[model samples]
Target: MPADRDVLLSARDLHKAYQLGRVDVSVLRGASLEVGRGEFLAVMGRSGSGKSTLLHVIGALDPPDRGSVTLDGQDVFRMPPRGRERIRNRDIGFVFQFYHLLPELNLLENVLVPGMVGRSLTAWVRQRRGLRRKAIELLEKLGLEHRLQHRPRELSGGERQRVAIARALLNEPRLLLADEPTGNLDRASGKAILDHLVELNDGGQTIVMVTHDADVAALAHRCVHLKEGQVTSRHDPRDAERPVQSVSRR
Candidate 1:
């Protein structure tokens, strides 16, 4: 941990398991981590290593059986259901391997989904213009300005993933959680998506990404490896004689 950076998210003694018939499979055992503000951290592990589970626990999407997750100084697991949902919606943004855009909605409409949550149709109608502008701004920033009216089925795989990224940024979240975000794309497409994420991180959007690809992990400020549900090693790329890029103002 750097002395100058503030810890934005922290997890301690996380443990999770599942029942399979008469057997219990433990996915995480005393896993702990700290992510600083504006940092890009990569969690890498083999299949069934509980990498995704850790991300879910920290992002408030799922709870750990025994552990504590603090986000921006708030104990996430201690919050009520509604409070947890609020944190998940307004503070943390998630991007998954599969582009989960609604097939029935256009790109712009899908991007507006987060903003419309918990709002009545009448209330949404009242604020629709501002929400639409925000969505348009996000899509434009993601290079999907011309495809705002296009449905998910009409776009290429890379384009669809871009739309998903735009949707994740619709709320200007404090932290972005990505689970194998480029798992479904080809090498070229994956690199493109990662480049976009790197750019975002450079601009002070904190990101925690889970990836199996070593090349992708190299782009992050730090990489932590997990094995059999425990953090095995932590590596800082800047310590390997690589120049550290200055983070830009958001």
Candidate 2:
């Protein structure tokens, strides 16, 4: 809702399906949305609602069967693999329901993994150091500064999830995609993670979070509900639906 922010990500009539054996399982049935810079938006849905599939499509990890996804005005699926890799590496950050940290690496090393893939050692070192600093800062913010050297196996569930958040922040991405970020945490820890996400949003991070928690969705400036692979409703929940305008595609 900030007046000065720019639209950062947009999806138009996105559809995704999987062919299993002889049958087609349609997941995302024409879901469209626009996310602006410095905005916090949440997608709420139950299990099998296709919210995570929609996030994966939007993140460019998987392509949609139909429609288009544009990030910062660039068509995601239209780009070459190398180009998409560059964008996925440098422009977008992802957080998952499961803490996907590598058990072999420590927190700092895990956070710097993205830097190791596409850049030269010199260039990597330059960004790596800066990103490392940011990672440490994020860990401190998440109350995990003491666990910097711990491996994923050594940390608690909440601590591991905090490391995932730090890893996602390593790229200073233009857009952050969180798929059920707090789904694995306890009630109090989930609230803590949500609070940290809100703090990041306050610091001008553009976040698109997929959550089933109504309280978590309420933290966002806007909330969109998805059911049966389509957006069913969108509103502020606290305000009249007339004032809470939203776009529905498909």
Candidate 3:
């Protein structure tokens, strides 16, 4: 860890729960963490270990019942509705296990959705050409240029995942949150996706990935486990009891 390491995201004492029928299931219990700029960190745990819940809270998609999440020093949950939405759109990118692509839209059109967001009809029209160019370049980078006109239903699982990655990157967000990006694909396709993530991280993109596979977690610069709602480093016994784990690139 560098002395000058910049912390881009901070979650302090986070707590979240869900009501399942008559039961209240607590997922995150005082979980906290810090992610540095230009770092690729992986959160690992067992099934239903609240890894996805942690990502959702970090990305500002779900608000925690207790504690605060700050991105770039701004408290996300404390912001206004529009402010939080802006951060989600412009500062964060998300890639899910299911590659949530629009089945009705082509690859290019789907990638353009982020750019079209928060823009008026006239504004979108003025920016469409440039946004289209960027989207194509992203598709080309992801090896999906030839499938630009292809719909999600027509493409293979890997191809759809690539397209979804391109869409998440359309806005050039500062943070990329991936939840089980390789869980649905075979080993080869999953390796390809992880390779892309490694390349992106090498280029200084910050990423927080959640996975249960230790092999997948090994690809990141650092790995932290979510146990009892708190992040702990298996490599460091001291971190096992700490509530807040500030992980930095090794």
Candidate 4:
């Protein structure tokens, strides 16, 4: 893993466009990005800047209009639909602004959903016991061990989000994609969640997150700024001061 850790994900000239009444509305226009293994990357942009679209494209949930996305050196778009789904199930985990937990299922059951996608109950139960154990461990790490038996309605927003994070990590994925993960929470809860993400990164989990908040973006090692469907700037906060000098020259 360490030998191949230099590049976990790479995107080149990525483009995504949608049709709206005979017009092609481009969402991602020649965006390029690379994420090293165990690196935490933040993407920031205003609404309509295509940040979320880029995340979805990278995750294989949506295909780009053009360009290539490679994960672990395999071309993501070259795969068939079923192949793509399989890759998503086996290697990618996703979190969103809304905790998309099932209302009727308890936390353990909810966390097991991804593993249950194409299996019988007995098989799922048998195969996913280890996953369940990992989920419990993740929840314990996120301070949600006591809430495992609770339903989504019974938990607060932050608790539900924590559960969602635990669910995302259940598969031990290499890439964790979060789209505005803290958009619905208060500042303190958001901060805590950000810290949790940082902890995961510190433990060698690769993450790509889309955040509208600059403070949250600052937590990542690098920030890719998007505008007009293109990646306009990339800021490494460690060298953030250099940009100030460049701007002053202008």
How would you encode candidate 2's per-residue C-alpha lDDT over 60-177 as one tens digit per residue? 9899999998988799899899999988888889999998999899988887787687788899777777777887887788888888888889887878888888888877889989
**Which sequence of candidate numbers ranks them by lDDT, best first?**
3, 1, 4, 2
Candidate 1 on 4-83: residue-level lDDT in tens? 34999988889999889999999999998889998998888876788888888999988999989998889999988988
Q: Kindly provide the TM-score of model 2 when superposed on the true structure, using C-alpha atoms.
A: 0.89
lDDT of 4 by residue, 82-184 (tens): 7788778778999999999999999888888887875668978788767778878888999988888889999888888988998888878889999999999
lDDT of each: 0.85, 0.82, 0.88, 0.83
Best by lDDT: 3
| Residue 41 local lDDT, model 4 | 83
When summed lDDT is taken over every stretch of 10 residues in candidate 1, the lowest stretch is 241-250
lDDT of 1 at 133: 94
Q: Candidate 2, clashing residue pairs?
A: none
Query: What's the TM-score of each model vs. the native?
Result: 0.90, 0.89, 0.92, 0.89
Q: Model 3 over residues 1-250: C-alpha lDDT tens digits?
A: 3123499999999999999999999999998888899889988887888999999999999999999999888999998999999999989999999998888999999999999887779989998999999999999999998988888999989888999899999989999999999999999999999999999999999999998776777778888889878887664433233332334334
lDDT score, candidate 3:
0.88
The predicted structure with the larger TM-score, 1 or 2, is: 1
What would the TM-score be for candidate 1 when compared with the true structure?
0.90
Cα error of candidate 3 at position 14, Å = 0.3
lDDT of 1: 0.85
Model 4 gets an lDDT of 0.83
RMSD of every candidate to native, in Å, equals 4.1, 4.8, 4.1, 4.9
Once fitted onto the true fold, the runs of candidate 3 whose alpha carbons sit more than 4 angstroms away are 1-5, 235-250
Clashing pairs in 1: none
